[model samples]
Target: MPATDPILPATNGVIRRSGCAADTVAEAGAVSLDVLAARRARSLPPGVRYELKGVAFTLPPVRALPVDLPESAGGDTAELLRLVLGEEMIGRMAAAGFTLGDFELVCEDWRRRNGLADGTAPLLPAAVRPGGSR
Candidate 1:
């Protein structure tokens, strides 16, 4: 299956078992939370210390903003946003000024409108199925 394919409801069970959905999403453009946190730390002002078990750690003095990850970190910015914020949460974020769009939903809607089966590739002229021509 293509990485961009929408995870259909019927396949949810298999996905839950295999745990490959997360991997697929990551491959599509999800960034590790660790990497994001580190990037945020670097943007903070110097000399900022956070108390943890009475140990002072000098780091950036600024609070991390809920900004979208950079494109370089994730090949597809929208996919990264979806992965990080999740579908529903992302809608709330979008209302708050984030420019990210729900690309997957859009694709799904398009597929349905075109009468294509969920997760099925679009028909191509001269294309043949594994067993025979369609």
Candidate 2:
């Protein structure tokens, strides 16, 4: 049957689980609490401690209207993380701290939630299935 049938409700009756609980996944990427305390001590200038307060990010956000991810980022999520941190958000792990692994984990989750990749999480057991339960 055509999906756009006028008689059918726009919804599937059951709200299956997707990548995110929110309606739209933030393009900046998902935040991880584990990275809240993300810090790496630096001695470049000698005893310059690094401390990130209130920001625990991984994927970083687009500067423009869900528009661009910065030209420097390319198609590489790791590069994106590296470049984005240096963009007026040193406290966001762009500084001399945080690792590629940290950023990648969050990006993976973001991808799934945004439907950019496979794995949308299984549909939760609903009270009723679509078109009504048996």
Candidate 3:
């Protein structure tokens, strides 16, 4: 990826804000929900989709990683890893000896990469604000 490009490029294509791949349209890379919360930025635009290996998956515009959740929260490890770090990232981290406990560090790296400050905060869905219920 170019230093000027804010989005991360995948082997198949670009991962959109919605986590969908667009063969033609280049998109800004996925943003961490924590980063958005830290900056008080608005959520990503709606209706975005991600494509991988010619298959598309509908996802939220802002891809929030579950880096803050405790392991006891319970879910598929690989799926959780994918949600937060993306496929390529998970692979790289795994190759480098990443563990579940390192999720916070990954989140911190993501925040710093996006030029956001390092901090802890709950990642609420777009429909649910910090103090509001879904």
Candidate 4:
């Protein structure tokens, strides 16, 4: 069946488990929080300290779609996480005294949400499955 039937209710779902982190002291490739805290000690606020926390990514349970096609029913939760996280990372960094200059929020948001090698727009709104739609 053609995907354009509009039989399926377009939705946005949370992505399943996957995540990555980068720190200020991040090496040529990757850096950990401990290293970041140490390297940026002088610049960091006096009361600030390094804290490591993990974020879990998980696929939301499969949802039933009005459409008959299996593909149309499945929501890409992982991709959503990526999109949210990427945008969140920028905000997080800003709060941490860093800026996401030249980083395309849309691109990062898209790639993370879709798990694409390159960023892409979300086919559905992010809040739809979270009990809201916009």
- Considering every candidate listed, which one attains the maximal TM-score? 2
Residues 1-134 of candidate 4 have per-residue lDDT tens digits of 77554864532222122342333433444434564454545443232122223322232212211222222324443334334445565455446553333234433443444344453333445555444456
Query: What residue runs in model 4 are displaced by over 4 Å at the alpha carbon?
Result: 1-92, 102-113, 117-119, 125-134
Candidate 4 — worst ten consecutive residues by lDDT sum? 59-68
| Residue 50, candidate 3: C-alpha displacement in angstroms | 20
lDDT of 1 by residue, 1-134 (tens): 67455755543222342532331224434543554466658755444333333332232211332332322223343354245445575455455554323345444544454455674544332233233356
Candidate 3 lDDT, 1-134, residue by residue in tens: 56455654554433245643333323456433553464443453343344333344343322344334423223333344365445775566666666666655444444444444444332444345444456
**TM-score to native of every candidate shown:** 0.21, 0.31, 0.25, 0.20
Residue runs of model 1 more than 4 Å from their true location after superposition: 1-101, 125-134
True-vs-predicted CA distance for residue 113, candidate 3, Å? 3.9
Model 2 Cα lDDT, one tens digit per residue, 1-134: 78686975554332224553323323345443322222212211221122333455444222211224433344555455456555565444545465666556655654444344443322222333334355
1 or 2, which is superior by TM-score?
Answer: 2
What lDDT is obtained when candidate 4 is compared to the true structure? Answer: 0.37
lDDT of 3 at 24: 38
Report per-prediction Cα RMSD to one decimal: 21.4, 18.0, 18.2, 22.6
